[model samples]
Every structure is written in C-alpha cells, then in structure tokens.
Target: MNEELAELAASGATALVSAMGTDLWQEAKGLMIRVLGRARGSRHNELTVALDRASTAARGAVDARAVDYWTEALSRLLDRDPDLAQDVMALASLRIPERPGNVVQLISATDSAEAFAVQYGSQHFASGPKSRERGERP
Candidate 1:
C-alpha cells in the first residue's frame, strides 16, 4: 500500500513538475515521493517528520509569484482531480489550531462557505493519525 501511495505521489509530482517547469517543484516532488514511500513502508514517526520537512522544503521553493501561480494551478487541478482536492482540503483542516476547546467553535463560526466546504470535505479524505502511524495507503 505504501508503495502504491508513493507511486501516486510520484506521479502527481511528475505531472506537477511537467506542468510547472520549475526545478524547485521537481526537487520537492522527488523528495516528497521518497518520503511517502518510506512512510508507507515503515510507518515511522520519523518518516512523518521527514514528510513534513519535505513539505516545508517545497514551500520554501515557492516565491510570492510562484505561490500565486501554483494556487491558481492547484485550483484548476482540483477541478480535474477530486482525490487531490480531498487531500488538499484535509491538509487545510490539519493546519487549523485545535487549542482551548474554542477551536471547534471558531471553525464553526467561519463565514466563508468555501472554507467550510473545504474543512468538511477534508474530514472525509484526510488521513488519520492512526492510519499514518500504520502506514496505511490512502
């Protein structure tokens, strides 16, 4: 399963790189593909940490203009890839702070319909901590 997911991530990365024509994106995608492979095979916390590092690396590779471009591209990509959309939405949910018990309330109060939809949709597709620990393939 881990191998499969790594392949999927790699394929996504490759597609992204081909579409974007940026070395940074290519490097980041390669690292992420490897990280996902390792995580799948071992289900280690260290692997998860590495994946996070890869994500950070990928983020760092983006300039302001690139960010805008990527955002637009991703929006269009999501329209074509429901799975990617779900993964992205789930990641956004994870980014939300769950502190002070008010976090839930705060999330509930958000006025943006898009935000709410993304959050709700993410739950359906986001990989759980336990599954991650077990290296269960998405």
Candidate 2:
C-alpha cells in the first residue's frame, strides 16, 4: 500500500480497537460496516464478527496482532476505493469520553527551559510505574 493509505490503515486500526468499549464503538463500527457493506455483501457478516473479536481483544489490551490484521484489512479496503479513504481519518479522530472533573495537566520546567508539552491518552501509553518501562517521560 502507499504511504497515505498505509498510515490511514494503521491509525484507523488503532482507533477502531480503542473505541471498543466506549460509547462510540457502535458509531465507529457502523462507519466501517457502511463502507464495507457497500462493496462486499458476502463479507458483511464475516467482517462484523471479525470486528467484534477485534473489539474484545482490544478491551483486554491493545493486541498488536489484531491491530495488524485490521490494518491490512482497512488498507486493502481503502486501496480498492481511494475516494473513501478520507473517512478513515475521521475514524481515527474519534474522541474518547472524559469523566467530568478538573483535569489539571501540569508540566513543570526549570528556568530557560525550551518548549515542552504535556499529553495523555497517547497510543500505546502506559500509566503508573509501568510508564517508565514503556519509555514515557514524566
């Protein structure tokens, strides 16, 4: 696959997996089904079941193999119909629900420090003690 389609597949795969248990899961899955349903009627049921399995795997943990599977699937889907490739970006752009609270994301820096940023919910992110092991900096 080309770079654009490849990146879209990777991101959409991640987004589809991450949206598994969230309220937007159905929304995400619907978009995918709609796209695929238009082309392959026979594959509709099979894809739906596969998507559910991917969701289950994602709910436990972001399974790399599952992600790879979906990535390839989505990549081919888009390659066959480049016009529809744009929608996959919207899939990746789905926002995760946030609990109501004061989210104080603090980033402390010493004097003369260069530009810095604070982020959360990064793909493959780790929390607590394991964050360091995952190469995340505090």
Tens digit of lDDT per residue, candidate 2, span 29-125? 8877766665454555777789767555536445688778878788877777776676787787777675445577777664434344545554443
Score each candidate by Cα lDDT: 0.39, 0.71
TM-score of 2: 0.60
Give per-model TM-scores. Answer: 0.25, 0.60
Model 2 residue 18 CA deviation in Å: 0.8
Residue lDDT tens for model 1, 67-97: 4433443444444443564354322222222
- The reply for model 1, stretches above 4 Å from the true place, is 1-62, 94-138
Candidate 2, RMSD to the unseen true structure:
13.1
Top candidate when judged by lDDT against the true structure? 2
Residue 113 displacement (Å), model 2: 30
Residue 23, candidate 1: C-alpha displacement in angstroms: 22
Checking candidate 2 for backbone clashes, the offending pairs are: none
> Model 1: C-alpha RMSD to truth?
20.9
